[model samples]
Target: MVTGALAAAGFAAGALLPPRPAFASEQLTIISWGGGYQDVQLRKSFFEPFTKATGIKITEDQWNGEVSKVRAMVQTNTVNWDVLDVGVGIGELCSHGLVETLNWNRLGLDRTKFLGDDKTLDCGVPHHASSTVIAYDRTKLKNGPKTIADFFDLQKFPGKRAMQKGPTSNLEWALVADGVLIKDVYKVLATPAGVDRAFKKLDTIKKDVIWWTAGTQPAQLLGNGQVVMSTAWSGSINNAVKESGLPLEIMWDAQMLSLDFWVIPKGARHLDEAYKFLAFGGSPKPQADMTRYGNNGPANKDAMALVDPTIGPNLTTSPAHMANSLEFDYSFWGDKRDELNQRFTAWVVQQ
Candidate 1:
């Protein structure tokens, strides 16, 4: 009876119901980062099951300039996206009134079952967790710098090193290198002098370091031996290790941990269905399945135990890795992003 009622509601709302509630809605679309094997996992785990269960269709598009797209949609009053996966910095922008605040309870997901009793909230739910780790080619550097400080100490660990070019993570890394405690990251970065101090510290390594604009670029550089040391995404570095036989090691100490969220725009056509899909995607089983294929740990804390042990340890959000690292404060970064970006841009261009 519930299934029939849902099917009727879906038909009346012009929303295609997934054959089952466990499946995704028909004709749903997702916006995500382009490339990487994560999309493949999404297809096999989420999209396929969603289609099969609900008899709903799914499509995905790369979210290259999604902010602009969202803004345009807002201007035209015609939102096209049902779900979006945005970075922490981007999430800050959305939180300022761009995207809708999700109501987990209304969506029928037991928040406690997913994110735990304390962490689950109505605003946004984390989708994947990752870290910025130091990956070094073992053959090239016999004793590569093991910590972020050593990564910045070019004199001792002399070789081509690469760091992310953008303002997002670099400023925090720079502050970390400058002896600011990880817990005090944003507090230090909040001041003009502290911001300058970070840029000044980064200036020392600017000339010798290669600036990587894309995530895959760092992995490619590490694989080709173009750089002996670099800050790389955990999954990308792992891929390099497996595919290219690069004797790369990740230093977990002082790793910058981050979480990405699945968000909905304010005026999406399929809010009800989108919320249902979010809950389904956030479930433990599907999250574990996602990790197996893409090496990304799902956002659900409960899902951690379900992941295969072999891949689980390497995941950024895994218990072992999470213990050694600091969670990137999304609220802090979201708040101070523009100031940091402006300062970072000036520093990068000066290089």
Candidate 2:
């Protein structure tokens, strides 16, 4: 997910949640990117089970990873959202004091058992790791695309291509498709010439590209033949293939792996209850349970062993998938996103 502030014009669009007491409350509100990702993976495993055990009814809300909404809530002291599922901009959120600095002892989970690096775990608990992989419907393309380069080769695999409307994985993938080795993607991307090269490659497909913002659109686009192939979230592709019986297949090469985190907005009313829910959801058991419903890998290290073997190969953490994967450089993006976002938008407007 692209992490940053979004305009909070629709902040009051959802159910108006009643504020909870810090010590005890019957209700605790948590927000995540809603859809099958939340409905199946989170609702079944975390929300429902946590409520059953603790009797804290969860008021679930959905957003598209809008850090600005959280920022607005914190600034106004109307923090109804207790726990947030954030991506990419966590360090900025922590530095700006938009979210609380988590007390690890309060959760009592083993810090070392978490899967992400130290920088990621500093302010928020790791929720799950998902990847942006090249996906296509096998039934449409009998001889399917096999690599990132194929996704760009209009002469060989000609059709409308779908990708999210941003410069996240798209920029990195453009470089890889243009022949930049995965190991040096960030190193090269840091240079001006490399950025121009990535844009130059994207220019080839700009006319053929179909931009999608919602997570659900990619699989739908592929399944319904709106496009021959797309850059889609692995969990969405997994759900379409497993549950909906879509003939979607994923190309894990050059996959951009990203982590989602559980954060508490600074003024969150239900601090105590929030910590309790975080601890329960962050444990090996609940973390592992997420895999039963989607392709995301468990963020708890011990939970990896507990993932059902049947679905293990489909997960981002699977050794086969990780062999050629590129970890999304949060630090680099945190520094460069705004500049690139502007550049990408300006480029998109050209004929």
Candidate 3:
């Protein structure tokens, strides 16, 4: 089964490329989950300019099960994907050994230019940052939850609240609920006992909360009044506020900040082209353009300067916004994710 999957991925990757002479101009394949507004901006701001500059033809393939595909490619040594965009958690896991270490200096890329410091540096470059925030329908709850802790405190902020079912943002929220300081979140989660305590706290509200698997779902529920207080993606919440015309407000305090990255798998076929794309993708202009179009903040700090002040204040990377929010520790979760997931899943089922 694994061999067949790898062969199929290789064929798919090859089939998407525009034929080019070997060792002349490289053909790079970018395996992304889907082309949302971000994809449109990438094409106009990054890909087109990159192709014109480097003479490299870039092709994109939509693959949802990214980790599986990357693993298959690595095992078969038939790596079809030269560039990939993945969540921060998965990016950290890949950095452990699954992906190639980026040569930033050789690519003329400076890490200091990005939003988060060199702490986010590794096998990939940070793409965009967003927050998991409490969004409440002003119509339903005149006084909504002001923080993540309030979102969990059903007694004070009584409502049918929605939260992500996955471990990505939940564990951090759980730790906060259990009275672990935000700065010491991962430090506590690093221990097996800390992981247990997080789940135990989650069990307390398991009956009152609705679990959402995807980012879009909770926002939809919020718009429809299916949920009054919920943890939602900042971008999705902004969309709901605009589309529904509801008096929905995001509580930025203690909001869990998350980031995504652009990565290259080990043994990729087009290393030079991929590096070119990464460096260009991380630049100020392209990053700013993407944020303007998608309402998602860029990882390039310089890009924030170019962003419109009206939209800038709401972005996760904004200085004002980042003040009250907490940066999620991807490294800690990446190391102990399997165990955390197993325990969280069992606890959810028991609830």
Candidate 4:
């Protein structure tokens, strides 16, 4: 009955798909960035429910968002991963045909219902929107920094700070901190001068910055008082606060919002099962249920309405939170990632 209801809603492609033999015992392999976020937000919300609903077993795996591994699998004709949860590299993946071109009709998803520009996403369906925001331990600092610029101001908030060890959000935050408006972030980043400006601003806090590679590091750093401020994924911080009772608070100003997508490897062996799960995962209720475990916003337009009112205001897409946010430009990064990543790496090693 529930599955039928999902199909009626026009996004439940799994229920609409032809049924598989009950005894076939086929299992779908899914790979994602594993941590508390995947364990709770995705596993609880989609994986377990998807398995129960479809009766198709799922074997989950973890990846660090390596596009090259996906490329190698497709190129070598050893595509083992059926569904992938990818971030930041969808453009290159689609352009290179590393992933399958989605059939919205087959999936039964309404393009209008999903967030993000259709032109920007062609190979995958966005499941949730998460943000990287500057977070501080409120218990430690009575008057915490409130803006992206404050994160870079060592004099005012004199202490070591944490930032992801990458060019993506760090570059954008630096640009915003240096006085670029939120909407013009990508525009300013498109030129050499703008890139230099971001790096120059980063230079201001270079010595005092502690770079983090793991998603859990920021919240952990804040909890341990290793750093007073850090740019962290919203879900990670929220999970920390909820589970550990940390007094962490996020600075929503200039939060960098990014979407995580469900993509199929170009030649997934379990194509049918992948599509079934993809469609089921895109449904509004599952997307909204994701937020019950963490703060990531659902991608389905209607899912926002379904989200618990208590959780809605804390989401990255919330009107109050979005008033000063910046959407991460995957397209721009698609073109400049390699170039800027190398530059960022070289800069990080310098004095």
Q: Output the number of the lDDT-best candidate.
A: 4
Weakest 10 consecutive residues of candidate 1 by summed lDDT? 113-122
lDDT of 2 by residue, 228-321 (tens): 9999998778877878999999989888988888988898898988999889978988888988877789878789898898888878988898
Give the TM-score (vs. native) of candidate 3: 0.87
Candidate 4 stretches greater than 4 Å from native:
1-27
Measure candidate 3: CA RMSD: 5.4
Clash counts per candidate, in order, are: 9, 0, 0, 0
Tell me the spans in candidate 2 whose CA falls farther than 4 Å from its real position.
1-27, 55-57, 89-91, 224-226
Q: What is the C-alpha lDDT profile of model 4 across 9-47, one tens digit per residue? A: 433433444663333335688999897767877899999
Question: Each prediction's Cα lDDT score?
Answer: 0.72, 0.84, 0.75, 0.86
Clashing pairs in 3: none
Q: Give TM-scores for every candidate, taking all chains together and pairing residue i with residue i.
A: 0.85, 0.84, 0.87, 0.88
Candidate 2 steric clashes:
0
- Residues 166-280, model 1: lDDT tens digits: 7766777888888988878878878888888888888888888898987778877876888878888877877777787768888777777776667777788888767767877
Per-residue alpha-carbon lDDT of candidate 3 for residues 52-98, written as tens digits (9 for 90 to 100): 66556677887664476678779899988898877754544454577
